[model samples]
Target chain A: MKDKQNLTGNLGALVKNFSNLHSIEPDSMLDLNTTTFLQKLVSKDVIDAGVRVKPKDYLKSLVLLEYFSGIIEGDYMACKNLAKISEKIRKIEDEEDTSVDPHERDSYLTLPVVIAEAALCANEKEDTYSDNASLKKIKVRYQNHDMKIDLHSPKSKKPEPYYDMIGQMVLDVTSKSVEHYLEKVSSRAELSSLIFTGHALDMIKSDSQKSKVKTALEKKDYFSASLEALKGIMKDITISVIDEYISNLEG
Target chain B: MGKKVVQGGELLFKEDIIIDEEAVRMQLTIPSRIPIFSIDEMQVFYNSHVFTLTKNSSKDAMIKVYTTEYGLNEEKSPKLQEDEYFKANTAEVNKLKEEFIKKAVIGMPDNCYDKSLEKQACLTLVEKINHAYDIAEHSYKAPPSKGLVPKLSDDSIFNTYIGDFERAMLLDGKVYRLETIQEYLSMFQKAIEPKFYKELEKKSVLMTPEEAFKELTDNRHKIHPWGFPFIRNKIWYNEKSFKIFLDGIYWIPKFASTSKNAEEKYRNAIERKIKTDAAEEGFGK
Candidate 1:
């Protein structure tokens, strides 16, 4: 009877602390809301306990089944805190105009966000890998298209770097003839034009323009003929025209 | 050996005199310009004594020399021997042999006889022939007449093929290239231009403003959802109603102008209405 009373008092204190932290007004909420609030309160307590614990020590403690089980109710809080961190990072990113130096900007922020989002969104959507094994394998559908890519990595892996590598690998594999893939992707959307990365655009343009130059060379007019065909490959234009020109050259 | 006298007017002859090797060598040294004879008819000659070098046997007529022992008795004289000097003249023979071999090398066939070269030439020739035949056949089939065929120039036929404006252009001495006009007719014979123009005129005369509004609504499906509001509002305006509501306005103006005794007043009014409506719709003012 004494122990039960002590547990009730601790729970009341946790609820009070959570309400204070989240700025939620005290009210009679539903069971799920109450559970969520308790989870956030417990997660804060764990963080408070780990204030002096090094990140490595904290991560080691998280690896233990006993420690992780004790924190099961606080997983939502950890996820929310991570989301808040990501939001803050995003706000900082938006303050600076990075359009002019998109590549450098993307390297700085997009890669990290892409990595975090891959894991976070996957977890949120119930698409996370089931195994806690070293190599965690998952598949994500890109752009709601038929293209599904498999990602595999160790559980101890940082999400950002892993996703960045995966993204680059996909780009490399598709780069050989990205125009063909882009055409298919755009057609599925019933679009006449598509905007892609500058590199992809340049590649397609050069490929098409080179052929046009070759044709001009065949016609014996090399002077006005341009080899610099793909200057603005990344810009939007009627894809059918490019496709027709390519087909005409091939014929 | 004693020299014997011949009868008057009879000539003394030597065995090798009739066939001189030197004369043969001279003739052989001259290169033949005729490709056919040099390639096909040249003969090879061999020297029996000098196995290393072959020469024309008919040339080199120097008589054989002999070494004699003067001490020998007349009765036992080494049975009149032929000369050993004929034993192959190695240096001269080698030189002649080299020259003959060089000439033979020069006489060898050229590389033009390869299969690919022959095939390419055959293809080119065939293409040229086919092109020439096509041109000739087309010319023969459609020879240009001295004057226009009366049947071809009939207004009814013109109206049946080309729309009113095109017909007028044809009759008004403005159109060029009869071949182009004829080709178009032949290509699209089923698409009678007069019938199309008449339908357009009927639509213009008969369609009501309400009906045009209904049509614009019906055609909304053909337009993008984002573009629908702009087009709908443009045609809905009262002042521009006639111009915006008319069906086939794009074709009617050209055909109406071609009508005989068409009044400029109606055209001007129509054009003004069209311009006003176009301006409202954000087109040309």
Candidate 2:
């Protein structure tokens, strides 16, 4: 009972602090956060006590408070406190003398765990997406069609232009094949001008593109000519596009 | 506020904790330009790796129990009495990882081709295509084309898979040759042009072997690099990032699988096993 009182007191303080910081009423948000967190906790089998104050409310309040406080004040301890509180709950659950599953225990790390932990607590439907513009500064988002989650660092001020170099074409502009280059430019222009006339090509457009394609084909640089043709039609030469194009051709 | 800790019988006052700013900044940050994967592929990814790392093994074990319980009789489910659940979970995780890795290949750029490394490149590309990745495997079994004639269907089929993408990019793993790379690139250039398809339409069959071979022979400089299609989905994690993700799984308790009530099921299974053993011992006595 004493432990439960302390848990409630801590939760209340956290709720008041978080609500004040966000400049919003605590009633509704607190309820939603508590419900979400509680459901997750129950599913995990972390709560062993028979009759109790909802431990998830305390966890949710602490998590929200730590998250906003860490970002806004840059006070790292606020985040650490969230972990400590979780540890405390685990300890409480463990004291019940029931056999515990090894997988149910909390796994702790020094640094990167903070981001994933914060992300786990993030509710997609909540106001965190819209109200907190600073949230974008962090990399935590539901990715892989919202099936997987990932987190990374924010962009720095450096002129680091990032690109997914894996499946993209690397166009070379510096080669000294002036005649070949001019031929490529002309062929590219010809291929690009043809309109998408449904899935199959129209006769006239097909004839024009094919002639340029054949001329390019006759030249030593068939690869560049093929790229121009695909890029012109697909508007982008990506693996997925190529795959889809092939699928259509096969069909 | 500082917290006091008794360490080795000496009381110590702890000050503010400093987060490793450098470590956090240096995380394997994938650029956003990477194309995201389809949902089906993402499902494959989660079923393979994430479930094990995130400690969803118990739930997975319960799922096996239920799958066996409902699909087959419970008599056949427990291969072993003591560690049956653990063994089942581990086996599934290992099998999935192996399956996924077989389909995974390192990201390849156009610049990966080198004349000096031709043999190695050819071997690696062929190995990946024939065994590891096998992107062309399904096309071999692809149904016949609608517009093309029966006699020329083989050519159309060849054009559909070999002549188009894999042959255009890989050329049966001989991408090291300058001519081969040029031909690969030219194949793509021609495929997009309206005239390329127009020519295809003119033929009763997709291609003659010589024609396909001629088309496959074009080369400019090189072809674009292709990573796995799921790379954009952030499914392709670097080694360090993979460890980080596994570490991250520890902190997110809510991700714990609760749907199956796995712990209860596990405990019940164990109890049943114990009771059965005791009954057998008593009968022997």
Candidate 3:
């Protein structure tokens, strides 16, 4: 919300920048509401960067941004519609010409979260919806929010229309558990312990291994590479920790 | 007299490619559209010897494109010869990269730590990858959230393919310069602090890669993977993008050379993120 505080000052400067960059009239470019909506949806860093990096995709970006805004604002219709669209997009029929790559669809699906994460990271004071607790609350709102879809209605035949509806409900219940499970599983000490075993430690300590880690670090895939290294480490430690922990618990 | 099959070169056009249905489809198919090469057959054509685009001095303003049913000669290729010649020029490219690093590049700024350049580089790299792979394109999509931070002690080769692909793009390019493709990509031995490169010139003490990595990872908690889907503005060579270039230079060992697997893992990770996202949205069922 503090990001909203700079809206008035930032808007004028941003509009000027956008207009200058795109060679468009300032008044013709974006209205106050549209600007505020996008600002609410993403960070100023994204906005400024978007304008500079891919000006051609600006219009399309606006449409996606608005859709995200609607979803975040607790619009069930938006959420339901996006879910349906996502499902349709994801469904790969053998003969379907329009069936996009899984990565592309995934990118579209994860855009909101990615933007939210970026905003959270880029400028914390300015980002509104990135706090984990806040996002959890939004998820709760989507789950508990009133919806008009009735499975018992006469026209609700074949259970097809209610498929996503059912999916929505299932996801709401399952995702919370998934989040909880992930949280419970991510014990720093335990994960570290798995990686610090004799062989794993030797791999980490070896000059070749350090060089390998250094290479991964350079590639910016450092995190996943690190995770992969952890995976390698856990090859020996797999399931052993659970028994050890269980024994500790029993003792 | 026109030659049999034109190989080892591209048809350079003097005019801008007009947008047609074919162009639009090609553009759409590209997933990530760049400034150059809009039309599939008109502006750019590659890898085939049966067709050629050559400079003809006829002033009719109509360019002739030659096509034939001639099968490609695998034993000896003009394109392969061209590639060999290009490969021989690697030293020149390395020199260019070195100069680009020495004079042009800057470290991550201290005050703002403005990462627009780095973010832009990622966007560019992602766009190039998407374009190359024929995947549906969404520019400025953030890298997977799970890989947001660089682990200090974590050493893994499974996720090093992206880096490998990037390195290939930079060093092996015959057409586009790496700096031109993603300006501000650092190719230096050290990841110096902002304006520290200039200081290094004076002091002659460069930070080691490990030290740089430590500095970058030390403040890793502050590092966020924020991005927008429509950043199209010119993000020229800057400190942040340079840092990314610095980060992208890794030697993949033979043991961890499963690039395909790494790429798959990368895709799978994105898919997982999408599921998590879909789960979070709840779809208002």
Candidate 4:
């Protein structure tokens, strides 16, 4: 019982601190949803005494487990076909690596929580989209279609840039070319436009943006990086627009 | 946050956690600009490897118990147990790590020998999972496309096996040579008013294929406290991301928009495997 109390206290503190830092209400953030597994662990007598977590309130259990295991750990089934999340913590006894950045490490330990929490809270009902005031959104809302891209890349900055990249055409609509025999070609991946840190292209320049990329990734701020990457993605339009840009130079 | 500790298939989420629709759509958007879910796939990958690692370690523990109880290997030691003597020596094996039971109890009743065995297996999984920190992977992706995402068809099939995304690697550069692209973009080549080639000629050309290829291939992204082991999604969760990645690399090269082709093939393979398994089951019975 004492352990459970400490567990609950520690959990409440962690959730409260996380909520404050992210500006999300504790209720809105990840719920320590322990409806299923812990129910099996705690007997019926405990449940009748009003200790049940209602539903999805695994917060205390999570902390207790972590205290024992040193990370959010479980292989128990909670639902069907869902991604399970666990946060990794550094143990006091282990040797630390000198090569990796601490902040970079922070981003990873928190990625699952960040991804799941972001996904749960992201706007799901928007009809259509554009975020950058500079770019005009030509796409209209489809009750069904507008949310498709948003579901997977919840962290992407805007829908317009993706549309713009898709709008690039390097081939004549009617062509006999073998390359045209393949799919439409855009020279860059959408993420290439993000140039916050040491972007593949940016690293080639005299002033490598390595620190910026490092910082953004370390911060897990792929959304901001996506905005810059959009510019980088669009620059490839010329290379696609002029099919032989690179070969023309070399040839 | 220490060093690369977690590995593929280790990033886990509660089966019940809420996932928003925007997050779902982000990967499945009909026309994606780039690949999605390097992090997700990697987690799945690491999770699988860890499961294997855990299972093997647990089994190894069982083997250790077997060896300790029987004292078989050393010259002139007790001989290997007969097939019928399985139950007699379990008490000896159970005590090896009995105290570990206090920490975790994954409740694998299948391990008939003891709590120690169960504790070791569960702890192995937990330790490996917790050990994962600050992980990321940089997946080299094929170029993006427009209007190429097959118009929503009832027929397009998405495959989620771990190998599916990598099946069609980046387009063979030799195949999409300059002439082929020029032929495809003949209009751009012929545009007199825009003079695409003249403008193209002016931009600082950046073709260092060998360098770019090596650099891009050498580059990768990672997720969480470990390296993602696979680039594919073995479980059902993020089919959309792997589907998009697969399509951009393979389907486009075949000059095909989306089709139910992969779905059909995958379903057929499963069907065959089931039939084969049923026959084997009959044999066992």
Candidate 5:
């Protein structure tokens, strides 16, 4: 019920991570909500060295980061769908031929989770998804939530029509789980990461940023690439959902 | 001077193709309405396909397609969102796969069956030289759930045959630096490897020694198999519309590549392969 409070637990971990990166104490950047968080990002000089999100429109980046990083929670499906619906709105704005199939959306939804799991684990350099803790956490989260999911032994699945009732359960679980997990993580250091989704590609400002993202993608450092792509979505497409949702949640 | 029987090269222009009642009833009939996938849908489709070597529906899987309207000499393709073209470059690679399967690809052997219960002579010991070993290997995976994921066949070799229906989406050949067809071939050899390999393997089987030599009569004809079906948007020199014969390869132009190449090849290859397969008189009787 205390949605923002629940999210802020994980948000606290975000602050500690930021503080550590800035070589400052944890007291700094007290409230990790969008607007004030932006201020902290600047004060810490975390702007250029770490997760170089655009200081200007980084709120969009934050929304994506928080939403996607939460994939480690049992409640991620709802968050992903909500983000996607928001993205669908953005697609319509850009006049894209969009078919956001509920079935196919899982792959799109799982991407950030996979990226987060890969990049945030302590032993990232050596771990594949099969062995990654983040992946295990998510699969466990889903199972604990009563969703039948088996990573090691997967069976073929059929596509079916979307149903609203199933959609509601997905949403309900996601909101509660995220709220619970966000508040539970003790510090910013405990936060898995949204680092990869925390950037924006404002090419109007520079081409080097684009090249940096491109080079990262070509090198298959998908964490870096995801951040860049999220930034691209925010910059080239629409950021209204991120901005509006966070603003409303913060209020 | 114009040449003899065209060797299924030179993407059959919209003007050159015509469909009638007979062509419609042929073995590889041009589909009345092919689903024009969005970027995301296409990405999933391309990545899931074993033929494309994209095993896991990984979003990063590379596919090739035609950028343009690389369909047969039809008046229209399924309508796209105005911005679908620009965004199409970033997603999964194939557009032709579904139609390829629908048109004329080989059947994958089904795997789901009850395990033969070897009557254990005793409950403990396993069977040594049993009839179970004689059972031909089959794909053990159960039939895929519908709507969960669109199914792709496991026939990898048959998948290679998809290439023989070679069509590239070259942006109407404007992006190329090719001075010769061979140059174009060399530059885009990777795109056509599937088709080339399929042809190399099948042609020997599909023809008699005498018939094979006779078939080279059209070797002088230039063919660029890449299809760009949507590119017909530019004011067409617009020839008479043609229908795919379904018994031979029909070239559609750069429908798009990587992403475009995958889709274009999927469409053109499926269409032509059906016609080619159906028309194989040698394989017939």
Candidate 6:
């Protein structure tokens, strides 16, 4: 019990440090071995003290902790899904080319993608041992490595006690999405067309309206004139475009 | 015949005398050897019917009398009929009345009755009234001129009221010289007007719509609706004006840059460049 308590305290401190660093750059690099360290801590004998906690909670917390720490690649399927989306955005921006010097464009694109992906995976499934098998399968696919994930393996006999952890994961991902969007566009006009379009789309109630708003946004009419139109349609909506997009992906 | 009885209007023993008391009556004849006295002595003799003669051998005899009448009488005494006392007393009373009228003419001067001067006059009037009461108890009278009197109808009216002394001295109309009671009232009215007008003007200006709007804008965050309704509705539509307004809103530090980090970087670079240039020019030394 004492060991688990110490581990929880350590996790909290790590989360705080990660947030502080994340604020400096939305996609700042983090230590790669963070998951290994977390795994080791959870393996302590005092982990039995966490028996009352559902496995879903524990898995959720682990996923959320990894997301906030900027440790996107992990054994969990949710973490892997988030990483895949981040990779796609980085690939589009050509962030991994060592020959290319670091630039604002890469950071801007990668940060939003990572945030969106994390939020989506976090929102999808609740934690269960059966879910982990599917999760491991997704994670293996995400790695693009030779290791195979066996979904048909015998399920664990006892119910895990970490469902609360999954809930935390969703919260963390949502927060990251907001933080990243704010980092990119502190000013209203600095918002990208994709984000703006997403927001405008969210405002639409019907398919026709969605198409119309999308068309208006694409033509850059949204910046020049469509803000009032958008306001009229969605007077009560408070979420920003990027946030809405991330939330949709998560949902 | 021990001594002769003399009367104010008669020579010694010359006049026929009659005496009567209760039921008795008597008459006597007079000797006319003595000369008739002067008119005054005769008047005295008539006034006092009883007179006494003091003997200094017969050659130096003197007569004296007591009289009830002191001034002109219609009958018996001809010399006392003149109206000198009446004329003298009336003249003295008239001279005193004229002096009282002269003292009542205190007031502010013509040039001193302007807007600013009116306030000063009010204060001065109050002080003078106080002083007047302290010195003269009964004789002090306030000025009668309406213009000179400070207007106490409304708060601002008293601002125009001039001092009582100035009114008494300078005002052309009837001087209602400030007496004890009126002086105190003038002082109070004068003192209260300026303060009242100041407060009234302040309230009027503050209550104006422009002032209220300014106050609203100052504490706007507290009262601002969820959204900037004015900007969203009225100001946002007009292209040219909206652009200017957006520029104004977006130009603030929080929203100007794509990110707060970018602004900090830009500022740092600018500062560094300025420092480098200064060093090159030997200005830093």
- What fraction of native interface contacts does model 5 preserve? 0.00
lDDT digits (tens) for residues A1-251 of candidate 4: 55433333332222211111111111111111121112212222222222112112222222222111111111112111111221213332122453443323321222123212222222221121244321222111111111212212455322221111111211111112122112211111111112111222231222234344334444544333333322332322222322232233335
**How close to the true structure is residue A233 of candidate 6, measured as C-alpha lDDT?**
34
**What is the DockQ score of candidate 2, to 2 decimals?**
0.01
Give the C-alpha miss distance for residue B73 in model 5, angstroms.
Answer: 39
Q: Over the stretch A1-251, how does candidate 5's per-residue lDDT look in tens digits?
A: 35542343234323322322232322221111221233323223222222322222233333334434333332333334344544553443422222431112222223223223223331222232335675666444323323222212323121111111111112222223122232332222222222332233322134665676667645644344444444444344333434553355346
Across residues B1-285, which tens digit of lDDT does each residue of candidate 3 receive?
222221234331212111122211121111121111111111111111111122332221111111111111112222343344336654653443333222222331212122343344334333433333443322222221223122222112212212322222110011111221111113231343445434433432234323333333343222221211111111111111111112222111111131344344444333322222322322112
Off by over 4 Å in 3: A1-70, A74-176, A179-251, B1-196, B201-210, B213-285
Q: Which docking category, incorrect, acceptable, medium or high, applies to candidate 3? A: incorrect
DockQ of 3: 0.01
Interface RMSD of each: 49.0, 24.1, 22.9, 22.7, 23.8, 57.6
Model 3, A36-117: lDDT tens per residue?
2233223332343322112222333333333233223333233333344334434542322324321233314332222222
lDDT of 2 at B45: 11
The runs of at least 3 residues in candidate 1 whose Cα sits more than 4 Å from the true structure, single-residue gaps closed, are A1-87, A90-108, A127-179, A183-186, A189-251, B1-285
Q: What is the TM-score of candidate 6?
A: 0.15
lDDT of 6 by residue, B232-252 (tens): 221111111111101011100
Please provide TM-scores, in order, for all candidate models, with all chains considered together.
Answer: 0.14, 0.16, 0.17, 0.16, 0.18, 0.15
Candidate 4 lDDT over B1-285, as tens digits, reads: 221212233422222112222221121111111122211111101101110011122211111110111111111101111111223423432331232232222322322233343334444433432232112222323233333233221111112222233222111010111111122223223322234344332321332212222222222222222221111111001111111111121111112112233333333333222222222222111
lDDT of 2 by residue, B155-219 (tens): 22113222112111111001111112122223345333346434433441434223432332221
DockQ of 5: 0.01
Candidate 4: misplaced stretches above 4 Å? A1-251, B1-256, B280-284
Top candidate on lDDT is 5
Least well predicted 10-residue stretch by lDDT in candidate 1 chain A = A186-195
Write the residue-wise lDDT of candidate 1 on B151-256 in tens digits.
1222221122222222111111112111221231233223334554344335534443344334435544443444433333322323212111001111000111
**Each model's C-alpha lDDT?**
0.25, 0.25, 0.27, 0.22, 0.28, 0.27
The alpha-carbon RMSD values of the candidates against the true structure, listed in the order shown, are 42.8, 34.9, 30.8, 30.6, 28.2, 48.6
- The local lDDT score (0 to 100) that residue B153 gets in candidate 5 is 39
